[model samples]
Target: MIDNEMSIEELEQDFWGEPSFSSYVVTTCHKARQKPIKDLSYEEIRCLIGQKIGLRFVLSVAIDILQANPLIDVIYYEGDLLLAVLRLDLDDWKYNQDELKTFISILQENRSKIENFEEVSNELVNKYLQIRL
Candidate 1:
């Protein structure tokens, strides 16, 4: 039986359309905030991120890309920018490069629409740096 959990190599082929980059880099700035977000706990951050994910379709698209291809992995950052790195599966990369690119393109296009998105730590002194995720 074909394993549902495709390897990273397979995913890469499915997405990039070639063995190009090991991973796809997606960097985005949060939506404008009335007051810059200050230091927050991991839980708080997760909640905020979740909110963004729901509000923004890009998040869903990203999730779909990962779900369709398990070889792809995601990394999120809570600093000045919301960055997500997707490690493409070889198969996915090869088969769906346009789709993968489109997904990321949408994220980049709508990044400016984030109204409450902000960094966990602004200029203020945030004691919470280490978050267990």
Candidate 2:
């Protein structure tokens, strides 16, 4: 479990030790966001996990930004990794143009945070795998 108190340095050490993890996470998120999940190969599950981890981190940061700025309201967050990646069979949350713009801007501004989150998530997953082995 990652707490908000965790610093970027900790996350970077955990997640960014290797370059592949960061690349994979970013690529996965971009691809998943554009395509339907049903079309993705089964082998891409790890990528989906990366997307989820990154998105969750982005959302957390976005929420914090909203709290501080109060510029826009975030009505819904797509929590389902499969649905979010595939963009299938999900509820449509309406957002005003300004709200949507602000949300995108916030996410873009905090791109580094998402990457750091991915690093942390990957580190934890790796640890879990080591334990299982």
Candidate 3:
């Protein structure tokens, strides 16, 4: 669990090991104007799972972004795999027939990064599988 004393920046640095997407603005829904959950360390957020104290920062960011564009039909994430279904229809031409294209774009752009992430997740999954077996 994240120590309640630490600031959001501190948690982001601890977990992601990089500068958070936004360091200055508070992103959470809290009335006190606290930073969003993205700043929380993975372990910290995981600890608060039952309480639902905050949104999953990474998931929220991605979903919000996708929702804004209006191209995605649906986005289902199974662990690290972001399975997206594009809504392609002639009536809604502006946002149609591009789901596959957008998916490909996301895959191409983030392939290397996601590949590494999946490798780690796969190892963990395999470990669990072996235990079950």
Candidate 4:
């Protein structure tokens, strides 16, 4: 089982070590990519996972963060992380079914945390569930 505490360095990386994108957010993701998962702030994780940069490595950490605080946000309002996560490609979950299952469980588990948050769209979450379930 890939627990939340695992090192992202353990995962295979698909990109070069340096920042390829010149944007500010991509720069932030490049920095976050170097840091240990435990060291990342919610925003950094959000950017990396939101952009699908090093997603396989960052996902478990991001989901663990979501499990802890489902409404975790960055520049956007609460639940921004979930919104980003919900936008991920389902193909990313192919070999990581266990992790995907855990992520879905986290969504199910955290429903109460998000269901009523004004900034989060419950309809989106439900739509994701309809596809994922």
Candidate 5:
């Protein structure tokens, strides 16, 4: 059985081997995919979620992390994680209602903090709201 408690690398994932993508973000997702959930940093989580690699496993963790820090950042700046989530496929969120709502709440609660740093974030956040989810 795949162990939630172990990293993909530790479990010796058989479906696919390690990926050596040319892009930094792509590489981050592969490296982060091998690390334990608890061991993953906010930036790594953001990278994985942004790539939509394993939402079934990673989405809830992202929610919990966002609850602690709605403005969860990456190398670029704050709210980058939030933006990554916003960019997630609408279908990816269809069955994830509770998690999606919690994320919306995080946006509502931290709107000012996000807008203060990323000027375009407000527009993106507004667009996210219009989605049927």
Candidate 6:
């Protein structure tokens, strides 16, 4: 069980194994916010994916924030692969293989419209918030 008192930094260190990766994830998220994700180079996307660390960091922070504030419904990653990390307890919801395939298809079809992480997240929320399995 995670302590409620733990800071995001502490959680990152404990869950992700390095505090520095948290900084990197934040910096990358900032950049994503400032620019279009579609404009980012493959290398930049690769860096944000960061051998798994970046996505994990982003998901961890998103989970922490959503636990306190449920208004936000999703966190997304649009890179070499696209993923929608829903802000719900794992016990409450889990996507089935068909749903996962549908999401991936939707992502691929709407690639041009999703210009940033926010767009990716919003797309998922708009499409999948009511879906459960």
lDDT of each: 0.31, 0.35, 0.34, 0.72, 0.72, 0.40
* Weakest 10 consecutive residues of candidate 4 by summed lDDT: 1-10
lDDT of 3 by residue, 30-128 (tens): 211144444544333322322233322333333334434322222123321232121112232232224334444554454455446532243332332
- How much lDDT does candidate 1 score? 0.31
Tell me the spans in candidate 1 whose CA falls farther than 4 Å from its real position.
1-3, 7-82, 86-96, 120-133
Model 4 Cα RMSD, 1 decimal: 3.3
lDDT of 4 by residue, 63-121 (tens): 77777777776667878888888877788666556667777787787788778777767
Distance from true location, Cα of 43 in model 3, Å: 20
* Model 3: CA > 4 A from native: 1-81, 84-96, 119-133
- Models 1 onward score TM values of 0.23, 0.24, 0.23, 0.73, 0.76, 0.23
Cα lDDT tens digits, model 5, 1-133, are 2356776455545334566567888778777777776688778877778777666567788888788977656667776777788788667876577788887787778777777765346777876666554
| lDDT of candidate 1 at residue 62, scale 0 to 100 | 43
> 1-133 in candidate 6: lDDT tens per residue?
3343433335455333323445766665445433333344333344444434334233333333333433333233332233324322333223234433454345445545554455346645445534443
Candidate closest to the true structure, highest TM-score: 5
Worst 10 residues of 5 by lDDT: 8-17
lDDT of 1 by residue, 17-116 (tens): 3324343221111221111223222322233334342112123334344334322223353322222322222233343455445544434444343223
Residue-pair clashes per candidate: 27, 2, 3, 0, 0, 0
Q: Weakest 10 consecutive residues, lDDT, candidate 6?
A: 87-96
C-alpha RMSD (angstroms) for model 6: 12.1
